[model samples]
Target: MTQTLEQIASCISGYDPNALPVAQAQEFIARLVPKVQAVERVAIRSALGRVLARDLISGIDVPSHDNSAMDGFALRGMDLADDGPTLLAVAGTGLAGQQFTGPVPPGHCVRIMTGAVMPDGLDTVIPQEFTTLNAEGLVSVPAGIVRTGDNRRLRGEDLARGDAALHAGRLLRPADLGLLASLGQAEVAVFRRLRVAFFSTGDELRSIGEPLGEGEVYDSNRYTIWAMLTRLGVDVLDLGVVRDDPQALREAFTRAAACADAVITSGGVSVGEADHTKRIMAELGEVLFWKIAMRPGRPMAIGKICEPGNAGREAILFGLPGNPVAVMVTFYAFVRDALLAMSGATAEALPPLQAVCTTGLRKKAGRTEYQRGIVSRGPDGRWQVEITGSQGSGILRSMSQANGLVVLHHGQGHVAAGDLVEVLPFDGLT
Candidate 1:
């Protein structure tokens, strides 16, 4: 259902614009983002990493016939009565893709290979290893060895016919391809990939390969945002760095809103008299500047931007903080999931793994904090997390040295050494 901004905000109890809780901010974004309705039919191999537009129902039963699970003899359960070394005649052989025509006579068994259909009136199988065969073409089973219905695969055991095997809103994985193939699906429908436009906003930020002045720093946030967005399988449009001028920022926002489904801008969202980035964003659309109760990414903005001259040409906007580390932190914490939802992908949280902290840490309550961590196995073969030096928002090197983010909850307090904390590894993000 489509909800207005006010309608979505009313759902949250005691909603505060200035001091938004981390969870509340996430919830607000979830309720506001709209899913893409465009879909395309592609081969199973091309469907990997694409969001499934609809459930893929199984038209036929998997393993449509009852077959043997192993190379064994197929015999009636009554043939093993009393388990006293029963003797049976080896009737014939049943190989895969070949079924025996005539039914087995009483006390007669059929030699069945793996995946071969069971012969008529045969309900049990004794593995060849367990049975001894003589040169006279007779097989003998030990007493109380084989049970009834052992090593037989029933029809449609893996998947039933006319059942929904795969659900909608699922991001297809490698295993999903093999599963759809088992269902005899040649092509599957999936959502279209999202197009995202991103840019950095700051007069002091210089682009790479350009001459850097003594007071200017190279623009690294755009590059980092580009990499993160690309990993999510979206077509990214890098708009480079928009200067501090209001007119220049406005023109860039207009172009981005008209062409892309989502617009991501780093820097100029925070309070700064030298930049009019937030003011221009507010003029473009319904922009909500949020001081989210989260460390390293507190001052941010979220809203939708519409093209100046074109009606209904709008895009979701994320105005992230200027700091390199903060840009990444905010993107991973908020924007990543929102983009996934917008692209019709399922909303799945990255689960945090518990790891022992190697050093003491200071953190205040009432706000969540994400500290870059080096997660690795200690000498004791147990997972532990070590905080990178200088947890400053501008220290991008710390993020480079870390493989995980040590998450301190909104209500969490100071952590001591050897304390178990939640760490989200980068490899776990999908």
Candidate 2:
């Protein structure tokens, strides 16, 4: 017999986000599961959002050699006197990407532009604005006493040779690409996107573009889940809407297990006349656990499914609730962390934020609650959150208007208007 929602949640409460203790899950998965096997060497132009497969070390010093950091005159520091104006001849001019080959003679200076390599035997640079240039190629510096290394970029100032620029298992951002380009790296090894297969199951569900039949509604959970998966950069294989047939659900689960790293389905996991996802999951693979003491998403299920040919490999399986909001919340709370772990990301459990409640809220004490609330800046410049009109699982409009979730713990009851509560910001997720 299936356990009650409260019983099931109690059994898993002590477990970490990976559904196991932190150290245990880390050790177990590290030994059993392989690192993302597929790696692609793509050009830096196309490496965004891809995980780095190896540490990037600088092959040579950045800026390679000493150069000028500003448009100025390059001369020996001793050439500038403390009180009197020192008049020197301008031997040559150096611009960006061009160098003055000749050495600096005594009482002589070279007009150097920004990013130009400093000429040999010259260490100090005075801005052209601070000096006067005569038509006869003579330069006069007034009260110019400069340091030896002033306005000069030393070799390897930005990055030294053999220094680790970026570590492995890091997701590449736009700025990361630019850093790679600065190091003259045209190609990088990155892990391939994880392929995820997902769907929704219910006899009352109907696909879009079809006529509305009696007692049928369009499947919105499938589209919403797909959008969320896309936002995470997962390669999604949408298995479409599956009816409440045991054989059909079984076949779809088998197909998904064969092709995807993880499979997600909404509905058909709760106790009902048409619920068959839990049964099929039991027959195909081990159902680790099901249900949780949480409103809206009590019938959540987590397990693994064995593929057809690959008997050893198992794909993760998650069964969410039928309510649209329940499905969305459960995906972010449970499945997102698991997927991030599989992608070699350093997964951290999100901590709830404290916010003052602007309105009184009512709830029972035995189950945890994720009430959608609107967060606004209080007159005191602190965040104040208030629950929306309704807390029903089917209220999708409330989710849109809500900016965060006011979390009520399992043992807590009603909260007074001015009491403090932990709120998870919705902007961080969707």
Q: Which candidate has the highest lDDT of all?
A: 1
- Report the C-alpha lDDT of model 1 over 282-399, residue by residue, as the tens digit: 8999878889999999998888899888757779999999899999899989999999999998888899899999999999999999999999998888899999889999999999
Judged by whole-model lDDT over C-alpha atoms, candidate 2 comes out at 0.79
TM-score to true structure, per model: 0.94, 0.79
Which consecutive 10 residues in model 2 have the weakest lDDT in total?
17-26
Worst 10 residues of 1 by lDDT: 267-276
Q: In candidate 2, what are the lDDT values of residues 137-210, reduced to their tens digit? A: 68988874566678988889999999999988877889999999999999998888888999888888889998
Assess each prediction's global lDDT (C-alpha) against the native. Answer: 0.89, 0.79
Off by over 4 Å in 1: none
Per-candidate total of colliding backbone pairs: 0, 0
Question: Which residue pairs clash within candidate 2?
Answer: none
Alpha carbon lDDT at 67, candidate 1: 87
